[model samples]
Target: MGQQEKVATSLAGAVSERVSASLTPVDEELERRYPGDPGTRQPVHTVYVPGEQFAADTIRSWGDRALAALDEHAPDAASFAAVLGLADDLAEPVYTRVRAKLEREPIEDLRVDFEDGYGGRTDADEDTHAARAARLIAETYAHGAAGNTAPYLGIRMKCMEAAVRDRGIRTLDVFLSGLMEAGGLPDGLVLTLPKVTYPQQVTAMVRLLEEFERARGLAPGRIGFEIQIETSQSILAADGTATVARMIDAAEGRATGLHYGTFDYSACLGVSAAYQASDHPAADHAKAIMQVAAAGTGVRVSDGSTNVLPVGPTAKVHDAWRLHYGLTRRALARAYYQGWDMHPGHIPTRYAAVFAFYREGFEQAAARLAAYANRTTGDIADEPATAKALAGYLLRGLDCGALDTAEVTRLTGLTLAGLQTYAGPRRGDLTPSAK
Candidate 1:
């Protein structure tokens, strides 16, 4: 006590204050621009149906069809495991969770596509279909039909190109107006701006949404959109800069995600139809760019869909299923965490691969995160960043029904809130206890 009391501080408080004053703006900028993940539940896959083809029973029909595909081809856990090369220990749990997910929530996010999926149509016809889609979606949400509506639902309008700008805007206006008139927008409403080629397009979208909000008396920035990276120009500008990053900035905090467009992006790179898949080098390059651009911007990245459909004979279906399963698993491992399902038949394999990935890594991730939270020594010396990742992994597994609450709690001795604290920001504030 005598020695400690005799010490005098050499660093002055005024110096610390001056340093902080110099860095205050940068601190605020970082906090405002990159607040990290929103800690919301992200869907596993988004299922797209043509605007005209979407109906109230669309979700239910997809679930039934997926279940039928499983029954006819896989038939049991062992067969399904064999087809996807799932581990023996994971076969039963993964298969059971896949079946349950399909039955309970076949489609987490649903996009009624008016872009390529709907093709060209007269302006009046497109407008009518847009209104109809909006009305059906609103009605489903209003009626509280859990099985009929996806957790997130929206439409994908045409690109803002010279030829289709007016049409796309009109469709968007009609659909949004229809929702406004139909008891207001649902909580899970999402929108996608497809084929964005420039940062100005994202800016244009923000202005459009602002105008819509003003016209409807809604709060500013209430509507957020996913930017579809369909064109190469969206990735790299004429000046050779990363246009996608600029697009996110141009969004003004309204960008929810960056969704890769498989065929369009691949074709832009001159990839042949046979090779224009999610795992193609071209596709990977674009998505990787998108991933980097969206890294800390509160915007997510989603992989694109495969054109291959799980149809025809059992052998053909099995082959398609295997391909889809493998691609989904690969995307999951890469941390894309979401993809697009073009067909109802893709649902079975989508959930199967997702469940397998989460369950396979569950125990290890939980243990490591638990150890980090408790400040205990482990095989791997995990830092704060890794603890955050591990927490996120388990949270995703829990969110998508791959990991049961009881099991997660039992394994980690942490509740959902505790896990969220580790997953969320403020890692420096974490103590050596499972708070």
Candidate 2:
């Protein structure tokens, strides 16, 4: 071989050996433990409600309420069509579709918040609210609200600060106990411990959950929790190193997700209230830190909400839609597939933005994926990364009900059988259409 080629080969061999020598048993164990990606259903957005207002039928009626708001504010389908930039002719059908989907399955994740939303009630009042929340959970399960509510339902306890830690624990204890006694824990039940500031808080929460499980006679680790990365301390250590890794490690496999609290996190960074938004650079930085720290650790990361909220007089309604749509689209672009939705008026734009984001790239992604699957050389080259992305895109579409198996198969030249084989069994019926 030429001298240059020989030198290149020698350098490659040296690098490979160095990499091999750097491997340790702990690294191998970590790989084995994490294994594949965490199997979790990521909802598009979570709806936050005050604990006092939470009830079994609250989520059930959200869709109708949202639709009514749309009708009153926008007046006609054409108004929403204008917001979405769709052709006038497609407006009514699109409106009908969005409304139907919302009615059939409105909220994807619901957070009954005791922190900010519920505010600081008196000790007796807080206890009363907790009991009411527990009873609501039981009634919801008995009334089949679990089936109708978002697939992931949980409560957000107050931050585990020194002054409020005991209060938070008490609320959780009372609520869980009441719910369990009334009926039973429903499927997809989780707890959200918010404004996490330290790794010890996470470990402590896990231990508390374990104790509760044992007391309730439930299986160990049956309860999972999510940590809210709100304050500045949660994302970065005093020494400037990322702290999310330590937080996840402390959870010991019960940390299902890491959620951003836009306003609180931004405020913690000293950003003025006017600038604390989901799309603000400060918020983006926090989310990036979270994504980096949680990468491949099976911890789903979510963005914060658009607090501008699509609620005002009729004259100001369009402006509200514009703001909400812009924020939602920005979150989706940043790869934060899930975010927070505060107002029912934000519902129409939420689904529209997600559907449009996926639909915009559908044709090209499908064609390239089909070419990759068929092993055909085409104008659009498919790399391993691109293939994975294409599969994920289609999977997200399917999961959100934006695309059906028949449509996916017809566009990609892949049958359901092929998708199942290629993507694995957990994909459910996300296969290509049967020929």
Candidate 3:
């Protein structure tokens, strides 16, 4: 045999000898330690409203309100026009298109909040409100309002603190009980557990959910929750170990996401109220930590919101839109695909910023992706890691309706099916250039 063939034969023989002599068996526990696959659908943003204000038609009304605000402030989409640097004449047409999209898919997720948005009420009033909110959700589901509501719908319970733990649990129990009684639970129903500072809290919440499933005769683990990383303790425990990872571990495979809370997290960090914003350095650091801890653990991380809401007279509304758009763009740059919207006015800027971000980079990303797929280097060389990132970007863009499948396919020379299948890391059975 040739010298190269002899070297290959020698290496194979050595590996075979090592494998035959090894006494250790494969560890099943280690094999199952990694997290399972993440959810297929992650909403672009979640709209939070007071529990008392929630109803089956709330999302549709929110869209209508947003459309009216868009017309009043920008008069045929002037706000987006300014942001996109389009001419005045194009504003109306652009506004029309955006308005249609808003009317069709008003919100991707909606959270009826009992924490921050729902202020402290008398005990009787709180209980009454909880029951009312539960009935609203039930009626919404019963009357087919689920079709109009966002794909992901749930409520944000009060934090699991000593003072409010019972209240929180009661609200969750009532809301869930009502929904279950209304025929069945809605698909993609999630509970938002705020102010998560310890792993034990996650464990307790999981146990409660298990009890809920048992009592309701629902499928086990049907209810999952998203943990809010709103406090300093949630970043690092007293012992200095990462608390986010611990929380995920404590969740026992039911933690769907980690959502940042801007004001509360900043307040806990001793940040001044004047500077407690989503893009604050301290907030960014916390989010970065969350990203690291949740990476590959199937826990999606979301950025916080801009409380400088768009309200009041025309000029103030314009200013608020500008600020919201800038902050949203910043969040998008930091890879926070999801955020919280406090008001209907924020919707226009949200869609505008997201669409613009995806549109601005489409061509270059497509070119590079195409080059990588075809095994040909383009203007900028594409590595496997960069290719995977490009593919993910396109996929997210498609998911959020920012980029169409045909456009992506035309630009990247890969059909939608092919892009979905072969856009990421290459498998042993699939060739990189085949798609």
Candidate 4:
């Protein structure tokens, strides 16, 4: 201490004070706009069911049907592993975890699709279905039975297009009003505003949600929604600017996510139906822009779905399963983290790919994070930012049933709080010698 204290800086303390004062507002602005990850457990995928078909047993039915598919086609861990081409070392663990996840929490998040999936019904029919969907969701959450309800539940209403704008608002109002009457909205409640093309569309959604909160006596900004980026104009505007960035700002701090609409978006670019896919170059370009725009805004970006359903003969189903798995795995590697599931049959391969992704990287990520936190020399010698990424990877693994808490603690020598600290904004403040 004596030797360190003996050294003196050439600049005066007043200079630093002046610089800090000059940057105070800038610092605050940065913090407000970019708060980093929310440090919550994000769902691995979103399952969309047509509004009219939603029921009390929807989640369980999906799980059961997926399990039945597994039973009839793959039948066992080795067989399932072979179908997906899982590596030898990861086969048994991934298969077992996928089956368990399907048996347990088959749907992480569920959305009642009142848009394309529901198509155009009479106003009365739509109204009836919307209320029914809300009632069913409320009942599911009210039961509070483990594995009985998806953690997050909501409805994806029609777009803000001039033709459907009022209908979308009316449906959202009915759905939220139903939830309020049931027992207040669940903490895990989610909403999606689909086919958003312009910044004003997002602003209109915010105002609608604000009006709903006032009408229902819920807290201001209590209701948030995903912005469905289904059009090229949503990504890039006529003025030649990144329109999605403005869309996020237009959300007024209420946008929860940016969900890619695979088919709609592909169609907007005039891709033939046969050529449309989540992995298409257009999809990648759009999602890549989306990823960058949402990097630190706490707004999640979800990849779109594969329309190919894993059904029919075993061979045909296997082909579809492979495609889904490959797309999911690819999306994960690109850091999309969440996506859409169109069919019950897609559930098994979804979990399989998600589980295998985390499990395969578990050991390396755990070691790297542990080394960073403990200040140990390692092969990677990761910096603070890299450490944050490693910690996030491990946390996502833990959140989605991919990694066990006890095992993670044992491997990393850190508690959940410690890992969260590493994954969060204050990570840079952690010194090399600090745990």
Per-prediction RMSD in angstroms? 3.7, 4.8, 4.9, 4.0
User: Residue 386 lDDT in model 3?
Assistant: 84
For candidate 2, lDDT tens digit of each residue in 1-435? 555543334366688777877887768867744644453456788889998888778786788778887788765778787865766555665576567667767787788889999987898988888888788766665665432556667689987899889999999998889888887787757688998988999999999999999999999988888899999998888988788878988898888889999888988889998898888888888899998878777778888887776667865777887888788888888888898899888888888777767776778888888899889999877787678668777767666656677888899988655654455335542222111
Give per-residue CA lDDT, model 3, range 103-150, as digits (tens). 777787888889989988776777777677667666655564422656
Best by lDDT: 4
- Candidate 3 segments whose C-alpha is farther than 4 A from its true place: 1-4, 7-39, 77-79, 83-97, 122-124, 138-147, 423-435
Candidate 3 residue 329 Cα shift, in angstroms, is 0.8
Q: Write the per-residue lDDT of candidate 1 for residues 44-153, one digit (tens) a residue.
A: 89998998898879998999988998899998999999988988999999888888777777788999999999987888889889999999989878884645667789
TM-score of each: 0.95, 0.87, 0.87, 0.95
Inter-residue clash pairs, candidate 1 = none
lDDT of 4 by residue, 149-227 (tens): 7778999998899999899889998999989988899878899998888899899889988988898888998888899
Q: Which is superior by lDDT, 1 or 4? A: 4
Better of 3 and 4 by TM-score: 4
TM-score of 4: 0.95
Instruction: Give the C-alpha lDDT of model 1.
Output: 0.88
Model 4 off-target regions past 4 Å? Answer: 1-12, 425-435
- Taken over the whole model, the C-alpha lDDT of each candidate is 0.88, 0.78, 0.79, 0.88
Error of 1 at 337 (Å): 0.5
